[model samples]
Target: MSIPATESDTATRALEVLRRLTARDDATFHEGQLEAISALVDEHRRALVVQRTGWGKSAVYFIATSLLRAQGAGPTLLVSPLIALMRDQVAAAERAGVRAVAINSANAHEWDDVRARLAADDVDVLLVSPERLTNPRFREEQLPELRQRTGLLVVDEAHCISDWGHDFRPDYRRLADLVDSMPEGVPVLATTATANARVVTDVAEQLGGDVLTLRGSLARTSLRLGCLTLPTSRERLGWLLDHLTDLPGSGIIYTLTVSAAEDTARLLAEAGHAVSAYTGRTDPDERVRLEEALKTNELKALVATSALGMGFDKPDLGFVVHLGAPSSPVAYYQQVGRAGRATESADVLLLPGHEDADIWHYFATASMPSPSKAAAVLGALGTEPLSTTALETRVDIRRTPLELLLKVLDVDGSVRRVQGGWVATGQPWEYDEERYERIAAAREAEQEAMLAYERGGTCRMELLQRQLDDPTAEPCGRCDVCAGPWYPTEARADSVAAATGALDRVGVPVEPRAQWPQGADRLGVDVRGKIPPGERPETGRVVARLTDLGWGGPLRELFAPGVPDGPVSDELLTASARSLRDWPWAERPVGVVVMPSVSRPQLVTSLAEGIARLGRLPLLGRLDLADGAPDQTSGGNSAYRLAGVWGRFAVGPELAASVAETTGPLLLVDDLVDSRWTLTVAARELRLAGADAVLPFALAAVG
Candidate 1:
């Protein structure tokens, strides 16, 4: 006798229970959330939930899973990146009388149990990391069995898949492939607290599904953001002690290095503030203990690296103080997100200093063995693939250095390897050219966004909203800038007066121009007279003239007597090649000629100094100069000055345009033109706009 459809109708009953839960006062649902849920139910397709931080995103998945389980549809599978989050969710599920289990490295035999339960259809939900999910044996043998009983695939911290995202994880790219191999068209529900429009698109694309975006307000009215420029580390500690000593509840202090974290924790503890340090180096048990202590408010503050915030949730955190600048806004946002989880007043303090930024830049631009190392490793492996350890021995580099090199190469698509081995995939590096270009644009956009936030005379919330693609978002009245109603009026009057006075002193009308002779002259061009001594006569435009006349090679050859005729020492050649190749120049010849003039050690330092100074001048609002010849002319160390200006400009535009294209709408503000970044953004935007290129402009001199 066949069972009747109604007899096995768990799904229908689950839907009813969901409706009832929504009706209860304690389970309030926003209209956007309701609509999002409705869409998911109606489409019967996988949906990605892209919501801002603190928007009750977790509830959507929890309720969805509960409803599905009640209907006997199948268990929900949550692929989380953080183990701590998995434990928390499991505990919460148990408290709610829902059956849940987690499978990770800690419980080595847990996978066997999980697989058995999945086969028997006895489990409600299973939580595991992407790494665990992608295990070859698990995928080949157990996954197929599990997939048949899996209803939903929830990817937490979904932004990690986006190349433009701050925390891009290689493993996440394979998640879409895993989901695709599932038996049923299991709906994927990805959730994240942060991600602008571009990030949203990236998540959808990565998951191979449509997005059900429920972007709640980013405005945290109860939270305050402030930057304190401390001159020394001691001062930063003193400031933290003064503020945190009497504060109630818990707090987190973010440091740049593991050593710094340990040191800071020690300092705080010695000063009688209960503090503990957490870093990647911490054992799993210690980390869990610290997290539990933080949750219980037993620890007043936890000094940590970026590792501490991923999966841990403490609703009562009252403060998030950054001991140093995070590498990017994404990181800064994540750290600050730990605070203000509840509807209470909180504060995020950024102890401003250049040390952290410098350190990050050092790592970002540090020298590494060329792509040849990857090639050599692949060659050594022959037709066979080697494990990471085996490959390290063959390459003769330390595991850490080798891993970093391989990761960079992998990201650059300069090499490919099997998941378990160092053997070349035989396929040429399938570079995601478009994706790489998009990331470059996004970085430029982010740089611009950063500068805009630092310099804009507007409400911080407004700037943030605009950066995040909420163009019409209203000013949040709670920010320092918005709180002072009288300041804007005074600021506007002062700005107008300054503008009027400058215009009078200059005695030149402000107007956009295709080419301004006077502006060109100030830039070292012989606009209205014969070429100056030591200048190219043909172009009569200084650096441009040099490039146009092909005099750069002759000039460089004249300056450096020991310059080699053929291949030099490997190190020297590599240095020379990188200098010639990597310098940010509008024209390649200019970079090639000028790179040798400044020593490699001094280049970045001088550039940083110049950028800092240039950032302050109003008239020089974003200059995009071509990298000039290194040899100085009568116009004052052309390469040094131009490099300084260009470097500053380069950071904003290059980073902004690259990032914006991948991550979406960004507001860039800088003192110099970021030509490289701008060129890329402009190219994409121009294509979208039915154009080829945006005409370059000198914001100050031309206007």
Candidate 2:
């Protein structure tokens, strides 16, 4: 393909300009970074660069704007989230002898000059925040001139637009609409350091342009991840002193609260280390001074809140230590990502006290609403838009419940914000028609992760890697399981044996596939006449039977080839009746025996009846079925059954103990295979307590 004029000459000129600019001692671009800049400028379509901090991301924009201006492409607009970062970039541009300016939240009249320059095609680039673009005056006045001559709309921190992003801002959603409304086919150049696959997709879709992803490997091989379980703040500070004392390079110590930051700094200084503190409460001028001081290695270590990391590109930061647990893994990752920017090995220490877990638990539980409250919020907002403040005032609920209700409403599309207020745009009664179904699905996935973290008896790193969809993961030999036994070795061995034994005892026998009728010719009356009685006819039964046999269950023992000679005992009959009733077979009748070749409806009805009976209050306590797949054992299966029993009898650990005494093989069916609760309870009681084989019923029978 022949290269476009904008692609060839513009990129070549941009590289030349960058080389000239970086020749001055004040400006510097790292090796090979100029090529990255060239590719970004050369691309006729929109592009993205996922470069680490201190890799000259700002230099790419500065050089590209100069090239675009020289190519007569009009002006460029840089939309960033932080105002301080905008000012820093404009100053940096001036130092490089480039005529550049910014119109941010602090300077309203500066935009008029920017607009005039754009009309005359005078300015190279104008940096503004997303919030400023929402202003009616700017949109109506300045945006028109810039749109007609705009070269590129650069979206810094592009991850904010994604729902799965760590910092999701509602205002970022309006960016796509703004870009589409722009004239002259204004292509976008988005940049971020930590976007995963989903974040990359969101940025591409939102920008409405072809994507050029420059994602480097996420493996920070140099940084060693470590966790410290401390009991008190005194001990934590002592540990910090031991690590940071006489450290040659600068480092960051992060705290959650402003007071904690100040206190930690004070303690470190008293310990004879040159230290400083930065928080939101710090004066802007002082904060800037502290950042500069750290960059120059004047301060040995900086004890600060999370505010210090964003937009502060310090490549040589030797270590980043968190005084307490962060709100989420994203926050932790971002903080840790600050160190080891130059591919130099760094250290990250996480000191999580007991209170840290409690704080996290509070946040998680407080963020979700009860089912009834969610329904109530939807009902109150019926077909109307209301602001969040208005809903809080109108809805009779507490803070936690109110936040959860809004989240549910937002997910269900029963409510949405138009402008600054919420609107009820969804069918309140239709659960399946939710617009935020994707959001809900993401939350459910996170919930599964949290549940696993709290209950799974495995390495923590393995769980995190699996949740984040990271492939090619090893055992992470540093976690609790890899370093030391999470459970006693003997206990684990016994538990595995018991779990295997339970399955062995409960599995039933089934007839061989070769002995059964096959193909259309096998469906005749005589062929049907040869079929066995008391087995439900279901489409999925064959699959379930196969699974049971593989798990060493009683599939063969329960369905031996020979017919019974006498009437079956009530105990055996009850077991069969319960199995037929509770199992999710494709077709079966309730309380009615079915020959293997019975009509589908008859089989369906029986199975349905059995399911219904087992689901009823009294009998429901006796059995628990997993959701989705009937053959698997899940935590929810046991939890739901235990919950049912608890609801009926107010039973707790005592009842659980009594149930453990049963010698007969217990057959449990779960809907899903990866339920942590089912695994926890079953492993604890059956394997640890020496129960008979615990068979997992694979088929979902009705009746």
lDDT of 1 by residue, 1-703 (tens): 2222254343344334445544553444543564444444445466766555666666666666776665467888888888888877887666444578888887777777877877787777888887765465676776777777787778888888776666776666667776677665566777876677888787787666555555666665656665665555545555665667644468898887675676667666866789999988899999899999998889998899878876778877888878777656655666687888774777766675445544464434332334555566556564565676566434534455566556556444444455576455454544445755666566656655554554437776666665565545577776666664211111133433432332122111111122212222344433433322221101101111111111222322322346433312333223223332333333322010001223232332233233223333111122233354222222222212322232222223543343333321211111112112222222233224222222221111100
Question: Each model's C-alpha lDDT?
Answer: 0.54, 0.53
Candidate 2 residue spans exceeding 4 A from truth: 1-12, 20-43, 95-97, 106-122, 221-225, 269-273, 327-329, 342-345, 361-703
lDDT of 1: 0.54
- What is candidate 2's lDDT per residue for 551-588, written digit by digit as tens? 21222333333633232333333444444454454333
What local lDDT score does residue 519 receive in model 2, on the 0 to 100 scale? 22
How far off is residue 426 in model 2, in Å? 13
